[model samples]
Target: MIDGAAKSRKAQVHRMRRIFLFTLLSTFAISAQNKEKPTVQATPAPYEWPAEKDKKYQISSTFGESRIDHFHNGIDLPGEGSKVLAPKDGRVLYRINSEFTPGEMPYGGGNTLILDHGDGSNATWSGYMHLKTFADAVIKNAPIAKGEKLGTSGNTGHSGGPHLHFFIYHPGERAMLNPLLFLNDLYYRDTKPPEAKEWGVLLADKFANVNPDKPFRLSADYPVYIFLQDHGVGKERWGVFEYKVRLDEKEVISTKFDRIFFKEGAWSLATGHKFEDIFYRNLYALTPQVRRAKKVSVEAKDLKGNAFSKTFELKIQQN
Candidate 1:
């Protein structure tokens, strides 16, 4: 007769194998769902551009652009002494004045203004940063009209140069939304697709050293990184709006830069949510157990629907 203890141990091993296989299958199913297109829950009201009608301005930076420490929270219109206007009807909520002082650090967004539209449940706030000063008639708790002059752009308060930092805030969630969604197509034009500068796998603390033109061996699993940027009509380097990663032709991660929020404070620039957490929905971390494919690909797109894609071959390193 067979030993009872040995039979029991064998059964346990079988059960554990089944559990592991089920988990792996479930993970792939979830990843496939994340590849679906995202939908916006709340559509914002129409708003006019905040720049002067007759003059032209260049976009210095686009929303969701990655910076050295933090992602750019708003679009930048670079111009010296450019007129800043209210995009919609709202009430001036707050204003700041940080006069330039040599050898002294001023406020983060030197000379700022916030306007509140609607009330209670539907309230939304529009923010203007790096202003030279508030408009002469603008006052606290005063109503502002659509297309009204609000201020002039300047290089004040921790700014590199003169520009208008514009953004929209959803009060209900306390998150920053991409203002490009609410603006008209006539405001700006971009026809070129985003470019993928580099793509590689992260090994431990650093990227695997391999020539990109040749096939690289990946001994261990690691997260992937894609350096992408957009180009506008003027050939300005800007930020892309969306990106996706695929493994062996199966999509693993799909993300769009639509909104962002701070985790620690209400609006601390330095400490905010991780890039993957806010934008990605599946296979975000790329743990060792999840890296089983030999082919990897990445795609990036700009706000105007221009897209770019590239694929790379990955081989499992032999011991």
Candidate 2:
């Protein structure tokens, strides 16, 4: 009887040990998974430029601003009044009819359609702003194919002549994502480095006591956008004045503009991977704590080596 009791105790201890080990492993696994899931949809899906060959257009402004007070909420594809197409396989969320009398600066974004991809991710919209009308088959809750015609481009909304203002949005957060990364043939890159428009100590936008002479270390959590204003038109050098972005004067990002063929006026632009909203938290290891009330300076230079500097102060906080 004593032997049996001892044996039973031993088995119970062994089972308990196994259970404890399993729970420990499970906890560790869950932690690893949490660290691995990306904040943004890094996975490239089947997305093509939403325009046909004869589509007369160019991409204008992009997501994230080099300036303050306004951040681009979406990618702007210059439609020069071309028929806009669906970005990918998705459902129409809504179609908004618009009026053009607002005197909005760049027109053609009127008569827009929103698309829901059902992935907690949706294109808040896609449409030929200032369009003549929807395609014959287009209707609310209708399915759209990639590159299918939705409407004929027209001069509507706030516009500069006839052009389509193509845009893409992260529906939930309403953040504008660079549509170029999602599109296959709709980008420009060149081997030559972009012209150096300027380089300076980047600071938080809201610095009331901005010290331009001081090399303020960028707040470790804040990512900086190097705004180049001198990107020229059709200069083969991406018409870009050129630029270099450095953290502590160490080159982290730099580029030369690749000049496009027709839209010499079209600007070539790019951003630092470390500076995106989705990755700002990850950048904490790289910068200083930029207080909300601070300003960063840029020492910009033109093609002729003419140098000018500007300071932009903005309102930022640790969210």
Each candidate structure's TM-score, on Cα atoms with residue i matched to residue i, is: 0.75, 0.49
Please give, for residues 32-108, the per-residue lDDT of candidate 1 as tens digits.
Answer: 23332333254568778888877766787888775432456679999878889999999987776766434443245
Candidate 2 Cα deviation (angstroms), residue 199: 8.4
Off by over 4 Å in 2: 1-38, 42-44, 55-57, 66-68, 100-108, 119-132, 172-174, 186-192, 198-319
Give the clash total for candidate 2. 39
Steric clash count of candidate 1:
0
How well does candidate 2 match the true structure in TM-score terms? Answer: 0.49
lDDT of 2 by residue, 122-196 (tens): 333443354646687677888877777777665554344555545454433323444554666434332333233
